[model samples]
Target: MASLSFFIPALGKEPESIEDKIQLAEELKATDFNRFNELLKQVEDSSVNLTAEQHEQFRFLDAYRLAYSGSQTQAVANLTELVKVAKSEKVQFKSLSVLLNILIISRDYSEVFQYLEQYDQMQKNITDKDLRQHALGILALVFNQTSQFDIGYFYANKLSSDAVDGKYACFGMQFKLESLHRLKKYDEFDQEFDAGVATCEAAKQPIYSKIIQSYRVERLLEVDPNQAISLLNSLYQDVEQTSYNVLITLYKTLYSIAYLRNEQLDVAKEYGLSATKNIKEDDINYAILLLYSTLYEIEKANGNFEKALTYHEVLVSKQKAYDDEKAAGLLAYNIAKANVEVKNQRIALLDKDNELLSLQKDLYEKEARQNRLLVLILGAILLLATVLAYRGLTGRSRFKKIAEYDQLTGISNRYHFNNQAKIALDYCETNAKPVALILFDLDYFKDINDTHGHAVGDWALRAVVKTCRNFMRNNDVFGRIGGEEFAVVLPGCQTDKAVLLAEICRDAIAGIDTTESGKHFSLSASFGVSGSDNSGYQLKQLLADADSAMYSAKAAGRNQVATFSE
Candidate 1:
């Protein structure tokens, strides 16, 4: 089957000419499913008399095509082998693009970094601005995915700054805005996105124009939902006339915004369904899951609890699958961190142990000398014994305190929270009582630090923590999860009561007078509240729901509270 498929392409094969190979590759990409398998077989055949370099290059292109067609796992495997062979064969940038695309598609971030190093070396031998710009864009995407926003911004800014005209500027600026968004630099996000939109419009880049418009719609939904809805309504009409991926993405975005607004659920559902219907089955899993989750929320809001629960179950299952993958990644990261920490601890402990041994040896020599002198042998022995006892006592006490207390806030950290929360959850579950999780975030915290100093920001954070502590019960658990975010676990609190308490906490922070540099100002927060029966509950799920609700509150407007249900 593979031979037959390759035979057709081989009849017209022109391995000597890159253009012919590129054209033929495109033709192979457009081939039907039955023919695709044949093309793959043909590409794998070794009887085509291709040189080693040509075979390696063809394999890279084949893997790239597979990646584009959504065979991600297979594509990654193929690309890994191709990269090995290409490096050995010293393949150039023309072949490098294929590997780059595979890296981006599979999100092989660490490998992408390694490839960037190779790219630097390869660039010294090639001179193609367009190709270089494309590679830079892909690199920016890799950085974005890996949460390296500053690096992504640096490369993206470079691309835009070096563009002769505004031709590639929009692409670069789009990435810049994305980096800013990820970094939580909302001010820069607004500025860059606006500039990108204007440049794309002036350059008549329709695809980018649509993308910027869609982004604007998304941004408007956060700041002003009514305005976003109006903008999306206009775009929806314009987009309905065309069949494009951007249009599908716009539909999904519009549906999500509308759902969050709690306006026009039926319309949102219709849009979501239509969007997925138009996409290929293999390409629509995430989109479908997202849409169905939105639908579930709408159903719950409308009092269709049974239907909502069904959708929620599906979403939970899907989320579990995603979480499993995330957990694996996190496990790898944690293992690396643990290994480094253990290595350092071992070195420190070894030094301390060796120092103690040396001290004992010195004392033993002194005792021997005293015995020889026949005077103070017993005194030296007593002093050495006292020193050892003191060291043992101090080490145990320090270790115990370190295990119980957080280093930063001097409060109970995640360890304490986990133990206490588990106990509380178990009590609530046994009594069939309610449990609430409240997640709160400081608004405009980055701006506060940029305007006031980091010291002032620290002062503000300490103030917020103090204020929050005043409202907590003796049994409640409060902990900082690092960086301007905090969590509170309330046992036996219902949804309405939890929401009310969250608002009170928000208002308390708002009322606090934080004076920095003799300028008195108040800060506000957004809250997400989730309450559950506590039975068969997962703490992580509660956190996730609370986070989603908090984002909803932020989307609605900051300085507010939102409750999660279903």
Candidate 2:
């Protein structure tokens, strides 16, 4: 689809379109500056009304420019903030793709894995075929880099399917080639590499073409150095990828390394020199280090002792500089993360302080009213003397039960349960003890509430809580998460023991007579159990596992206990 068009009256009333903006973005993206700042200023100055889709397109464009031009740290920072504003799924997918790629380039695999879930959730809502491919293409790249070859191949190949085609088509093909290479499927790699090369070249994506060449040449170096050299030579011959100087340097460095190993000292030195010439001051530290070391080794092989020594000293200096820079960057990232955490903590504290202040204000106002009533009855002097201490004390205690317990069941409420659950989990975790979390809900609870009455429903909930308390250990944390839902956290209990307890509780509830007098009826509930593996020990984790298990139990049949499946 073509981009929306507008006119800028100040610039000779020149016409501007999305293509014009994108072309400008590409030019600026090659530099270290914030891409499209000029265009951003121009757009802000223009009072053009953009449709929702047009607006979203510009958002995607801005993030792309940032991701392309900025450093990994800057890209991650900007994209993280952009995701919240990218309400459209297409825009969101594009922004997240850029973000995940930044993480990949930074080698933050754990964060990539963490974000896969977010991507999956977002993709589930996106029905646009191209957007789906865009999302899957990012996931495929992540899996490929993480060495999950089978999974990577599935998504990449799926994304490459012709049902979805666009600018991101190369991404799917790129991941397919990479994952196959890592899996050591050489024949498949060769085929995909050739196919990807054609597609990227035909599409005029020189950077993508260079990337394909880079990957293919790596495998060729192992099997046939001559063929690898031929391919690498072609890349340098046609190397208009000044925007991708990193790849050119990397390819050149690898070429030098390969020939140096093959005892072609003179040829290796030539390639090494070319590689060094490609290095930029702002290039990636690892690539710069590799190029220096590759050149250093080639010179050493050629028996130029003085030249080799000079290169060695340079390499050492660069390494230290890189290390220092890395340490500083990591410290900054950590400090930023800590600041966000502290900010959230302050907001929570302020909310709690505000609630307390509101409570105190209410109490003061009530006291003043009481004093005024007393004055109306027995003059101002006597009003001050008349103190109703009991009434004052009673008002404060009225909400005490609400804070600690479920009103209907007289058991712990969600707030108290969660608070105490965390404490119990922490203690068990520290002591190397087992802990199990069991979440359960009354089956057909609404049916009972509808057919019988809310009063009967309330009685049934109380009865269930009473029976659960009977089975619960004194140290166990038990509470109602909400209506018809309750949790029992057992410290020092393993999966089997927790499931056993759930079974016992289930049976006990089955025997509960939910009706009063002659209207007797039995009640049943489904239970879900989860135990910590020690690797993952947290209340929220356990609660989620147990909640999932309970739904499984409900699906199977009520009055049964289920533990989370692998």
Candidate 3:
């Protein structure tokens, strides 16, 4: 509601009134860092003495500056002390807010939930309406991050409905739209999208408006990729001009997916790479997940399985870390909540005892029953927590396995194949051992699918894999890298040995009986062999050379092994 009189105050005429100082500090701390620092210096130098409360408020503002300006260690230390000692309720609340902001910035969800419990306890003592709305708005954001979209939506609705200031209203609407998008409440999202954008724009919060726009793009990406790319192109420059790294990464990731869906491989890879190259360690996990996952798909589509595997691994790792952090955060919050409940129960029991002091026997019996109930409830909570933790661990393991192996054939999928291949190649290179790669495709496989239907085709694929697996050595890496296509990486093997193995596998495939598949279909495969000595010891190059040789075999005649010449 107030504004700074000047960017930086002159030598002596620096706003002397405590109210002006507070207003100036609030205005410039987030938007104009240099001026805020100058103002802080002026406040420290001014001869006019301030009351204790005023000094505490100024200290809180200074902490806000520090937290926002990359000096979070000192800011957190200062705010931790200020929250406990500050006399004014507003200053205490502000300090807590800044501390929460720091944790959020660092993506420390566990500590965030821990502090959130403290903030919840203090909320009842806070009388300021705007501060209360601020708390609600931040709660919405934290819940959104923690994937509790329902709770996030509820808080955002409350904040929006009760907001007197446009700032809170903008944030409320922005997160509300996000929750709806994430929750897949598309009808409601479409209904509220325009109004939310208008509210953010009216508030002059370009960041929030752009965020809402990003949600629209995300939805469009699923249903209308062309439109998503067009909209992203429109917003590209504007997003770049802003300091919001989240939006920047999100837009680029969206562009990558949109282009990938549109079959624009080169452009998609470019955007995907650009987005991931700028990722920061402390950037939000949401952005990281989107960026890496999209890149994985893009690389896979572009036929770059090596890069695809790398991206897939990174995505899984990041997602696991994020889930673990969120779980810890929820655990901390629950622990704090349980402690608060226990303390409240004890206080209530003490009050009941004091009230019924004359009825001593009845009071003692009631207290004993209440304590027993408390113990049961706590034990149940602990058991539920243990079960959930076990489920999470198993769930992650299951997810990882599903991602690594093909569901259809139960062998390593393209991602895992490339990963294993790279490892084998690296080891071979280090040990000065030869490595060979074999690429094989089931010739006329689609004809089988079209003539006998996919059921028989699937059987043929499985049978072929079974036949080939019997010939593979223990150290050889075999995987289904494509539909009707497979690869094998053989370490400590020369080109001739690899070609022999391929011929054996090919003959086995041809000899397989097709009666078990319900319809008899003869299977034959084209094989290509490439060695590290010829392909320069790089997996990509090896794959390329083998692929070229495989096409040569296909061109000459199916069901034969061809070796790379140069």
TM-score of each: 0.46, 0.46, 0.57
What is the per-residue lDDT of model 3 for residues 1-566, given as tens digits with 9 covering 90 to 100? 01101122333345767567666776666667787777777777752676687788778877877776779899999999998899888888878887887787676776787678778767657777777877887788888877889989998998889878887888889889989999999899999999998998898887788888988888788899999988998988988887677778878888888998899989988998888767776554677798888888888887899989998998888899888878866656555564465457667767877878868878888888878867776888878999999999999989998999998888899999999989988899998999999999999999999999999998898898887876666678999989998999999998987886787688789999998877887889999999988897898899899999999999997788899988
lDDT of 2 by residue, 1-566 (tens): 01101111232323387545544543454342353567655554542665566566666656665565555566677677767776676667767867776776665655665566678778768876655766777667666544567888988887767433434566667777767877888888876777787776765667667776777777777788888888877787666545466766777777886797688988788877877776765555556797788778877777888999988988988999777655544444333343345456667768989999999999999989878757576775565555565566676677787678777888788999888888998998899988888899988889888877787777777778877776565688988887889898888888887786787688778987655523466688999998887325788888888888898888897778889866
Residue 352 lDDT (model 3):
79
**Top candidate by lDDT:** 3
Best first by lDDT, ranked = 3, 2, 1
Rate residue 23 of model 3 by lDDT: 67
* lDDT score for residue 455 of model 2: 78
- After TM-score superposition, what is the CA distance of residue 46 in candidate 3 from its true location, in Å? 5.2
Error of 1 at 304 (Å): 0.7
* Candidate 1 lDDT over residue span 293-404, tens digit each: 7768777877899988987887777777655544443433333343345456667768989999999999999878767655455677878888999999999988876887
**lDDT value for candidate 3?**
0.82
Q: What is the Å distance of residue 320 in model 3 from its true position?
A: 2.6
Superposed on all Cα atoms, the candidates' RMSDs to the truth, in angstroms, are 19.8, 20.4, 24.5
User: Candidate 2, residue 458: CA error in Å?
Assistant: 35
lDDT of 1: 0.67
lDDT against the true structure, per candidate, is 0.67, 0.71, 0.82
